[model samples]
Target: MLQLASGSSLLAIAVDRFLRVRIPVTYKSTVTQKRSWMVVAICWFTAALLSFIPMFGWHNYNTWNGTTQANSTSFECRFFTASSRSYVVNFIFFGFFLPLLAVMTGLYCYIFLTTRRQLRLNIGAATESHTYYQKEQRLAASLVLVLGLFVVCWLPLFLMQTIKLYGPKIEVSSLFVHIGVLLSHVNLAVNPIVYAFRIPKIKEEFKKLYMRVYHDGQQH
Candidate 1:
């Protein structure tokens, strides 16, 4: 539920950014703070509702063999696989893929159209537009990279789930499963790094902080 909510929020941000760049006048008038908050509230509510449904026995966690073992400790804890293949399919399609597709489409289309419009301007106007366009390009590129990393990190698990649903029964190695799980978490770590590097203001603040820490250490 938390993951779904977070993904939805990211998608909303992408949409907001797209609107601001592509249709600034309309966005300014329509996408006010109150409306944005309302959208966020709806996303959270929907996420919570979807998550709650599984608790009513729509899904089962006891299907995996490792979970049935009595001696398993916290370190040996394995994630629960859904008992129903349909549940997995529904989750992947609606929860991850659809939202991802929406965000990618909005972001990339905005980038393409915005870039094209900028290109069509006179050379003098183009030079004047460069700074603002560059900023938007950086933001779009950062979001795209984030989305790419998200897909890369989650693709293995998604593929594994799909294979389990359709392919012949074969024992998947625990090592591979663990690696996929680790990769999924790498996005969390990479997000901050991406933002810090791509945003000029953030980069400047980081440099200032680093210099301050270094100077303080020298003084001490």
Candidate 2:
């Protein structure tokens, strides 16, 4: 659910940026704060809806005619174990991941290209054009870095889950699972780094928090 939410929320940002680039004149009017919040809310709600489908017994009905047991005795609940093969293998990887990847990639690429072309047209005519272009590129770089990190980190876990869902019962190392989980979580750390560079308020608060934590540790 967290991954789903993250991906969807990022997609909203991509869409917002796309609107900003493709329609600058109308961007502010269309992409208002209320609308932004609405989009985020919709993304989270949709993510939760899709993520909880397995829990709501959608996974009980398999791809075939087989019906899964409603109850289990297992203490440790793994996603691959709890989820249906269809949900784990097909829907998440194919339906969500691939489509989201394609859409976000397309949007960011379009935004970069469009802005670059526009800047080039105004190169000598506008003195501030270079500065604005650099700003756009920096923002684009950060956005891509965050998205790329998410993809790189989560791909391994999804692949592992797919293999576990379909492949023969082979004892895989828990270490590998833990590593995959760690990588997926590491994607989250990129957000703070990007925010620190982009938003001064957040950067100030982060510095304060770090100093407070370090002082407390030293006192102990």
| Residue-wise C-alpha lDDT for candidate 1, range 3-106, written one tens digit per residue | 56656666876877777677754767889889999999988997788666666666666744345554545575345454455565467545666667676676
In order, the Cα lDDT scores of the candidates are: 0.69, 0.78
Model 2 root mean square deviation, Cα atoms: 5.5
lDDT of 1: 0.69
Error of 2 at 109 (Å): 1.0
- lDDT string for model 2 (1-220, tens) is 8888989988987887788677766878888899888998999899899998876675644622445443567544354544676686689888999899999999999988988887788777656656666566667777788788889998888887777767759665767877787887877766778768775667899999999999999999
Best by lDDT: 2
Candidate 1 lDDT for residue 75 = 76
Assess candidate 2 and give its TM-score to the true structure.
0.75
| Candidate with the greatest TM-score versus the true structure | 2
Local error of candidate 1 at residue 194 (angstroms): 2.6
Cα lDDT of candidate 2 equals: 0.78
